[model samples]
Target: MTETHEIGMVYLAASDLELADAADDVRGLPVVTQLGHRLGEVEDLIIDPVERRARLLSVVSGGILGLGVTERLVPVEAITRVDDRVHVDRPEPAGDGDGRHRGDPADLAEEGYQPELVDRPPFAEVYERYGVMPFWTAGYVVPYFLRR
Candidate 1:
């Protein structure tokens, strides 16, 4: 099987999901840039099952009739502000051509993910392939700031 499929399997293999149907929390929230560039809408939030916090912001952009819909995963740190709209900073230059930010795998090591898991093959590759940051890679403070 292709590595991409294997990576997806890893995600599926996760038995302990943080929030059952996390998308409900942030669905319909407009995500924009500091300049008010309508990046997209918050399709879902990938939460760390262990941390009970969001690890990635899944943004959906440029899709019609479910034809060309694309999901971009942004690191929680990229979020500069959140209120009526979920505001995020511009992605770094290292992003993929699709305008999605590519999170650094090294941060995973610092985030205290199990060494065995981080060191294993395909974890980092999977994360890089999807351009998402592992939730364990950073501290999440957005949930507290939001008006629950």
Candidate 2:
């Protein structure tokens, strides 16, 4: 039986292996599958206020994004275990047929980093209409938000 109610985010593992002893964790782990893989696993967790738990909303699925991969929504409860590998049961998106949920815009806007979005094209238009000012540096226009 599990003891801790509040999750201990960090854990331990034993090491020391020979050259042939191991492959890359993602490539070798059975926890990774075609429909989804651990690489696409979330690095940072997001807490949904309504749901009230830390969920695996997105994963760092090893393609190439700032946090190392894309942001997707996964359910926190779907986790069966987390150990030598991360495991999950992927979720179906909400009724709109997009991965997005129906909610207050204020909630989502509160959830993400908008300074970058403010500087871009369509995003810029949206933000400007909403009166959001994009980040600027030396008066140059960046395609996306970049830190100064």
Q: What is the alpha-carbon lDDT for the whole of candidate 1?
A: 0.49
RMSD in Å for all candidates = 11.3, 19.8
| True-vs-predicted CA distance for residue 136, candidate 2, Å | 40
Shift in Å, residue 17, candidate 1: 5.2
Which tens-of-lDDT digit does each residue in 1-148 have in candidate 2?
A: 1111223111001112122212212222333332454435443333322322332233334332232223333333344445566465433333322122223345335654321111112323322332323322255342211111
Q: Per-residue lDDT for 7-60 in model 1, tens only?
A: 232221233444444432665798887788887887655445444455555576
- C-alpha local distance difference test of each model: 0.49, 0.31
Candidate 2: C-alpha RMSD after superposition: 19.8
Q: Give the lowest summed-lDDT range of ten residues in model 2.
A: 8-17
